[model samples]
Target: MKKFLLYFLCLISLTSCSLFPRDNTKSVKEHTGKKAEEHQITPPDDKEPNHSLLENTMELAQEGKVATSNFAVHMNSINDVKKQWGPAANTDQIGGIYYANYPAKHTVFGYNAKNILVDIRSYDEQLHQLTYPQIVKTLGKPDYLRTNQDDQIYGYKITQQFELRFIVPKNTEKVDHISLLSPNDTVATTTPPYILPIKGVSKNLSVTAWQNMQNWRNQMIQVAKNHQNFVFLNGPNKKRVALTFDDGPDLMNTPSIIETLANYHLKGNFFFIGEKVKKYPEVVQKAYTNGNLVLSHSYFHHDLSKLQAVEIKTDLAQTEEEIFEVIGKKPALLRPPYGAVNNTVITTAAQNGYKIVLWSIDTLDWSQMESSNIEYNVLKNIRNGDIILMHSDDDKVQTAKALPHIIEELTRKGFEIVDLQTLLGQKAYK
Candidate 1:
């Protein structure tokens, strides 16, 4: 009788434990106030899947690699995915890329038009949903880290094979989702050298541009040795010239100009007006990331010669802040608007930790001259250590047209094209 009573008590204890779910104190709900159920996956028919249906789906997914209801990562057939998951609740196509969303499972799958599964993603609710702190604790440091606009990402390599991405949303420290992807399909593969572009421009451009600039500088040093009377400023005594663009990072023209520079595997120095930088910050960012030097052309593009010393300082400070916000760095060089400066401008720039940069060869592209004239002016007077000035912003269509020709002519003449930082042997930014 006593043995039977003990067995009954043991059974009751087991039943009580089974009745209570393990308390996941670190669950998403505890931190974000949103229940896991609220973020439940949406079904294909634009209706919510019943709890039992979702539970069953999740159970099936848990048995797979990425936890999708039917198909798995790297799955090749669109028909197979549809046959398994029924249909996506929502589908979108952009630039020939297709994306399907299963709201009920909190999963989205992407495929090429050919229907090859490129990637699969899970949203806020997952079996191992973790905060950023917990992720770091579990995964250690990430192999790569980057920010996209506002969201931050931590990337890891698992066993040197598959890639894992942890995405932390802006303003919230908790990780919103985790993606398991093929290493080749991750951003690391797309952006080479494995480093994020400083401002969305490839770091490869920066590396190549710097190397070419240095080689040119070395050549110029030898030339200066032979000709004592040769006077060059801001560049080494070699036959290298720095290409500088000023006035604007206009929405339309700057990107094309950047592309042109990239095509030649060359770098340019962009002197951006403060207001324009505010308007077209991304263009300036691309210039910086593509291995170009970004400097200040004053905040308002006003002639520093005309502004008071205090006013000039304020203008420069404002511009510096704007540049820093975009690139996470500050300009170390300044170009007074109109190439106009007084002792006050110089003193203020010095006080503000900026070196004043002026052009050696003015292309006069700002004159809205003919493309032929702009090309002629640049190629005609170009020499070693010459800072060739051109305008990138504004409606300077002719300048844009002549840019490639100028680069080609210079390359043909054995002149190395570089930014002012390379020519002057100074840091581009602070």
Candidate 2:
């Protein structure tokens, strides 16, 4: 079975595609909401769409010596498979890969005589399900869970495996069973060595577009590191340019900007004033729902560099509280009013746990330039890494008119535009 699965995976690999889902818009943070558990099963050795598991397993068993058999398959390389199963494991002829682990955190890999992963019933303590005694009886008493209020239900940490958590029901002392893959499971995968081919596009053009995106994203990170402020959003490949509209949550133009971004499958960062969010809760919600990063621009668009420490703190905190009250997420990034920042501003921003973001490129669309000029200037000087500044509301006529062309022209020149949150590599405010 393992050999057959391997061969199947190999054949799939030849086509430059993956069976794995590729949608990445979902944030990596764990969602606590109730969800149905999804379990994945390996498909047939052939792409003919077979779903008979019993028959498949039987056939694999008949094809003995699968261990030594070089059946080309595709889920991942054999070497990669070997890494999952460790050394000291041997393969047998029954078909699939099998492995075992002792009481300690070590793995043994091989095909069992029955050709299945070995999960021996070491000690059954199902009765320990909801009691403090369960912990003592199973994995020994907790060193920390007992002391932590949040972890009273169940907690266990392996040397390298995840820190186990049991979400007990409210008012219940007993643990409600829960399991998680260890933090090690969350290690970032190395960048794919090659681009997966895209269908319906010229192969060369697809590769070039992918490379341009990678370059642009890397450049955004490099530029962000030089400044104390700046937060990145979205995946590195999507786009890195921040579309900030100062003095908004504007009722007039905010909706249009939101509509435009949504149409393009993109979002932006809104450095809104406190007054705006309080006044237009709907607009604030719209931005958040659209995946835009709603950050603090101050209670009013006040220059932080000129404010006294107390005034600066008051302004920042008030803005943060107002924004959070409406959006349910505190702003982690702040754009100083008019992009002004100094030592005082920097210290104040740091104290508030907010990074100050500045733009690398300004479109001056606020001047309400001809949409043609706005479009031309932005595209002409655009590079792999850039942050184009334009207002969401003030230059409504010019910005709205220039939006499509700016997108088309920049994209044509091999530049990928992205949201500020992605460009700065920071989590969204929410």
List candidate 1 segments past 4 Å from native: 1-234
lDDT of 2 at 350: 56
lDDT of 1 by residue, 45-99 (tens): 4322244422443343333235444455454554576656655554443222345
Which regions of candidate 2 are displaced past 4 Å?
1-239
TM-score of 1: 0.46
Q: How much lDDT does each candidate structure score?
A: 0.60, 0.49
Q: What range of 10 consecutive residues in model 1 has the weakest lDDT sum?
A: 192-201
* lDDT for predicted candidate 2 compared with the true structure: 0.49
lDDT by residue for model 2 (185-287), tens: 2122212211111111112235676576456445544433322122322223333345566678777678888888888887777888898788898999998
